[model samples]
Structures are given as structure tokens and as C-alpha cells.
Target: MPEPLTIMAVHAHPDDEAIGTGGILARYADEGVRTILVTCTGGELGEIADPSMATPETLGEVRERELRRACTILDVAHLELLGYRDSGMAGAEANQDPRSFAAADLDSAAGRLVELVRRHRPRVLVTYDDDGFYGHPDHIKANRITVRAFASAGDSSAYPDQGLEPWAPDKLYYTAISRSAMATFAERLSAHGINPPMSNEDGDVPPFGTPDELVTTTIDVGSAVERKRQSLWAHATQMGSNVFFARLPPPLFNELFGRESFQLVESRVATSLPEDDLLAGLRGVPGGQRHSPAR
Candidate 1:
């Protein structure tokens, strides 16, 4: 029998999945796509944004449960963990930990992800860009491993000891936060007489978010916004009162979170530009039609 259509999203932490790719995850799952989330770390050093939720020692355990709840809310078909520790923000002490995702051996981490890719046999793969979105150490590391897995998973010679069938995904995408969207959010915040978090004093755009032209696909998740929001709330230990997401009114929040964007970094199949759906070229496609992996 033909394999099920699948999407595998690799992330650095529990909540990272919600903020970046929750829309796509929920939207695709609703459409009967098999959504697989591979989180690389246990989020061991995450701060307790909700002090009443979890203590430092139990944060990891709490986060695992939270992530499970989020997966359920998003209707994800599978949730996998790479079992590495969180390497706290760039340059933080946690980066030195041998168990942290940032300190993990490249081939080893990529091997772990590659195993999942082969097992899941996804049609699409997603992760952060080279800059790792906002440059967190674990995020940067996650990007590296994901890129490596995307390139190596299909090669029978790669990680041969695994004994799993080689499976190459048809496309690879980088989840992106658009600069235009951020700027517009800033404008909306200003018009509402509320100060935007982490905004520069002079109203310059924040350091994160991709330029509009760089974004290759924008998926409107208006129908799945509730699931995404619930997924966010599931990570209660990470969602404190000061969070901009929680502070916004319902309508504004819905409007801002209604769509998600991605950059198509690699594709083995032919596709047109300005895509509105992630499965544009893959739907009804024959496996024989996909191009072989190119080095």
C-alpha cells in the first residue's frame, strides 16, 4: 500500500513547535495529513514563566506533558523526542553541558533525526533557517541537524547500521516569521496604546522575522487558530502574563495568528511560486515523479 502523506517538523524545544509551525501542523492534521513533530531537547533549562506551574527541577517533566497536550490539540499523528537537554540561550552556561542539544555530536544528532525521517517517510520536512530564527544555541544546533538529516536520510549508505529503509522527503521548508507581519503587529500595538515587548525604543522592527520577499509560502490557518492558541496555552509554564500573545485581544490575536509563512529551501519536485498550500506539488504526485536527491 502507498504510504500516508506526512509532514515532519523538527524543533529545538517544546513550545517552539507551537510558535513557529503550530498553524501548519494543525491545518494539515485537520486535512487528514499525518503530522510528526520531532523535538530535539527536553527544555531542561527553560525559565518558569508561570511560577505556579513548575519548579526548575521538574520543568522538563512538565514540559513533556505540555508538549503531549499540544500535540493532541494540534491533532498530530506522532510526537518524537531526541532526548537531549536544552542548551539555554546563546552563550548561556547550559551550552557547555555535554548533554545539551547544542553540544551533541553532529553526526549522532543528525542520525537520530534521520532515523525518524526514514521511519516516518514524510513528504515534507520543516525546521528553522540557518540563523535558527532568533539564534538560540539549541535552535542553531537543531537547524544544523535538520539540514543534515534532510540531505542524508534518503541515501542508503548513510547511517546504514539503522536497518531502516531510506526515505527521502520531497520538500524541505523553513518556518518563518515575516518582517512585514511583525511591523504591522507593531503598528497595531501602537494604535492600541500598548507597548510591544522587546521592541526598540525608536519603533524599529525587532531583530527576528524574515523579509517578505524571502517567504515562499503563506498558509492561512484561520480555521485552525483555536487549536494553535490552545497549543500555546498548553505550554503554561512558558506562557506568562507579560507574553505579548496573551495580552492581545481576541480579534487582534486571531488576525495576527491567522497565517503562517515558510521559505522553501529545497524541493525534489517541481512547483510554482507564491504558494498558498504546503502540499501544492505533492498532492496526487506519484513517487516515481520526484527527482532523486541532488548533492
Candidate 2:
């Protein structure tokens, strides 16, 4: 067998990883790929969806535990928190907190992430799009830091004292979910008597090259739907065991939501849009050809 591929997923909070790429991550781990999740905050500002554990004082710790459980389910090889506090939403008071993610020390934070990149040496990195996968301020910041860190991670002169030698990732992708997917999901949910909260009147997302860019790559994770469910269940404080997703039949979900989505943001190698696989653009790089490392 070939050497195990390494993957690092950077996100602003605990459940974000699983929600965004849990199924893909599960598939990667099942195939023996080395996957890591780097969360930027403790999610102190998160709300509790589980009424049983609904205590203001206990939610943060509970969510942390839940994140660990999810990680275990996904078979993540490594996990790290950037140690920043959740910034909450854009105008929230949490955004002004000195310890909030938005207020994090940029250079130092970048160095920390860069250190991880040097240590893991993943070939592919995944993060949110320019809109930050729904325009969350913290998510946007995470994307900015990840992009910046990727640039400096491989430069020996950037942070030599941090640890391992320099190593740059070969490709970077933006996690994307298109309007078509949402419409299809809405139809699926309707079949089960679940009307979507949002409608097409909310504003349809345009195709990739037409102006409003959507995803081009569709990564199928139908086989790993159960793993993704378990991972999502791990975020108990945010999503309880009896949530809407958990209540659904796995088979139905797998058919309707068979694939995870993403946009090819930047790649040194040649690639095309509307591709069927995330690993498609990753082949034929400086070293041996490899597909998308992990989720």
C-alpha cells in the first residue's frame, strides 16, 4: 500500500468540522488516511440545543466533550484548539471580547497554525469560502488565517523556532454547498413532511463562473453517512442525539445528500471546475500524485 495521506481541516469551532466535512472525514479515516482537525475556539458562546443539559454554566464544557466524541467517531488522528474564544456573530458583544477569536493575535496565531502545517505536512488543506460558508465573521477570520498561514508555513524564515521544518500544502479548497443541493434537500425533506425554513425567495446562488460562485467539486460520501451522523451527535450541546438529522432514516439521507461540496480555490496544478472528485486537481504535483488527503 502507498503511504498514508495527511489532511488538516481548519475551522472556527468544534462542530463546524463535522457539519462541513464530517462525512468526507469519516471516509478518509476508514480508508486509513491521516486526518486532523484544528479548531480555532472553545465555542463559549454556543447555545444549547439539548434541553437536558441546558445550563448556562455547563454548556461550554459539555460542547467540548461533545466535540471530542464526534472526533472519536470520525477517527480523527489528531486535534488541536487555537485557544481563541468564540467571536459569536458579527455584531454580538462577544465579538468585542478581548479573548474573542476576532481579537486574536494575528501573527502569533498564524505562526501557531503554520507550525502545525510544518509538523503534519498535509498535501491538501480545506477551509470555508470567501463568504466563510454563510458569512460568519469568525469563519471568515479562520479562512484568512488559514490562507495566510499556508503562505508562511513552508517558509523556513517565518517561524524557525516553532518546531519542524518548512512544508507547503499543494492544494487548498473552499467548502461549498450550492443552491441546487439545497433545493434538492428541501424536496427530500418535503417528502418527509419537513418544510424548509428558507425558500428560493431567499436568493438563489448562481453558477460558478457566472458571477455568484458556487462549488465545482462534488465529493460523494454516501458510504460514510453513519460516521458523519455519529460525529454530528458528538456535538451534543449544539446538536442533540434526537435532532432532526438523527431522526431521519440514514438510507434516505444518503441518497438525497450523497455528496459533500467544495470549490477549488487555489492549486498550483491544473484543474477544472464542476469536477466529480476533490482529489481530481491534486494529482500530478511536485511529488507523487495523490488525491484529496482526508476530509
Candidate 3:
């Protein structure tokens, strides 16, 4: 039998996996891919959206437990944490803390991710763009380290002492929220007399979305939308029931999120744009396949 394909998604915090890549992860796992999640921080500084669970002292532990449940819902094959502290929103005091992920040394943080890349040997890696989606400090730091690790993990001379052989992923993708999607949501919000999140009073586009032209892949995860929703709901402390995502009717929610977008930052395989599958053109490439590690 051919080896199963593998995909690794590197995220900044616990809830991030659900918000951005939940659909893809659940769909690929269902299709027999070895899905791995590498979370950069403990999300210690995240706000508790649930009023009843607002114990700041235990938020980290609660969020960790929520993440585990979410991983299970998404059928993630492996979960790893880089063990860094959460650097709160940009300009927050946590950003000044040495232990926070945003404050960590770039080389050191990337080295930790390199170890996991070598061990998993995934054919694809999914991470944030240079802007880190919404530009949160930890998100930007996660993107920095992940980009570095993607390049360094393939170079044998780099981090040679990590005890794992160098393994290069066939493709690197940035999770994207496309401008088209944002526009559609904006229209819906305006129709309902609600202020959209993507615009200011001046009617100018915000920095939160990627240009539609930049999106190279759009995976149809319609079938996995329910699972994705369940995964997001698992992080109860981070998301409230009435938030934007939760408030959207099921049909509209699926319409917006059912098709996830990504920018193919780098690829070693031959593939065309607007791809419907993340593993497009990779199945037949030499050295592009991977097997699940033995139990």
C-alpha cells in the first residue's frame, strides 16, 4: 500500500487551529492523512469569552483542555506545543516578557519547530502569512518561526544537533481570508443593519484580509463544516455563543467558511492556481509521499 499523505499546521494558540484550519484538518484526516498540529503558545493571556469560566488563573489549563478536545474533534494525529508563553495582543505588557512567544529568540523558536518537521516529515505545512493573518504579536512571531523552520528543516547543515534527519516539505501554504469572502460578509452585515468587522466608518478596507488574486488554493470543506463548528465550540472559554462566527446562521456560516482559502507560499510540485485540494500535484512527485509513524 502507498504511504498516507501527511500535513502539519503550525498555529499560534489553542483556538487558532479551529478558527483557521479546522475544516481542512478534519477533511484530510477523514481522507486518511496524518494530520499534525503544532501550537506555539499556551494562550495564557487570552480572554475568557465565557463569563462563567472567567477564572484568569486557570484559563491556561482550561484552554489546553479545550484544545485537546478540539484536536480530537478534528481528528488530529499528533499534537505538540513549543511551550512558549502567549504574547498578548500587540502593545500589551506580555509582549515585553522574555518567556512570551513574541519575545523569544527567532532562531531558537524556529529550531523547536524544525525538530517536529523532521519527525513528522509532512508533505505540506500550513502556517500564517507574513502579516500573521490579523497581525497579533504572537501570530506574527509564529509565522516568523514557522517560515524559518520550513527553510531550515530542509537544510542538513542547519540544526544538525537536533538528532533528526532533515526533511523538506513539498509545499508551504498560508491560511488566508480572502477579500471576496470579506466583501460578501460585509454586504450581509450591511443588509442586516450591522456594522461589518472589515470596514471603518470611512468605508476603507482593513488590513485583515488577503487579496482574492493572491489565493492559490480553495479547499471545499463543506462536508466538514459541522465538525469544524464543533471544534470551534470546544474552545468555549475563548469564543462566546453570540460572537460573529457563532451568530451566523448555519447556511451562511457554511457558505462563508465551507471553502477555506490559502496562498501557496512555496511549492516543489507542479500545480495550477485555484486548487481544490491542498495535496494537488503532489501524489506523483518523487519523495513527496509519507507514511504514518509506527504505533
Model 3 reaches what TM-score against the true structure?
0.92
Q: Give per-model TM-scores.
A: 0.95, 0.84, 0.92
Predicted structure 2: clash tally:
0
How are the candidates ranked when ordered by lDDT, highest leading?
A: 1, 3, 2
lDDT of 3 by residue, 104-177 (tens): 99998999998898988888999999988888998898889888877778777789899887888888999998
Candidate 2: stretches off by over 4 Å:
1-3, 197-214, 240-249, 272-274, 281-295
lDDT of 1 at 231: 95
The lowest-lDDT stretch of 10 consecutive residues in candidate 3 is 286-295
C-alpha lDDT (0 to 100) for residue 161 of candidate 3: 96
The residue-level lDDT of candidate 2 at 207 comes to: 37
Query: Could you give candidate 1's per-residue lDDT for residues 1-295 as a string of tens digits?
Result: 6777899999999989987789899999989999999999989887688677889899999999999999999999999999999999888888999998988999999999999998888989899989998889888888899888888888888899999988888889999878877778788888987677667787565556888888999999999987888898898887777777777777777777889999999888889998999888988875422334556
lDDT of 1 at 44: 81
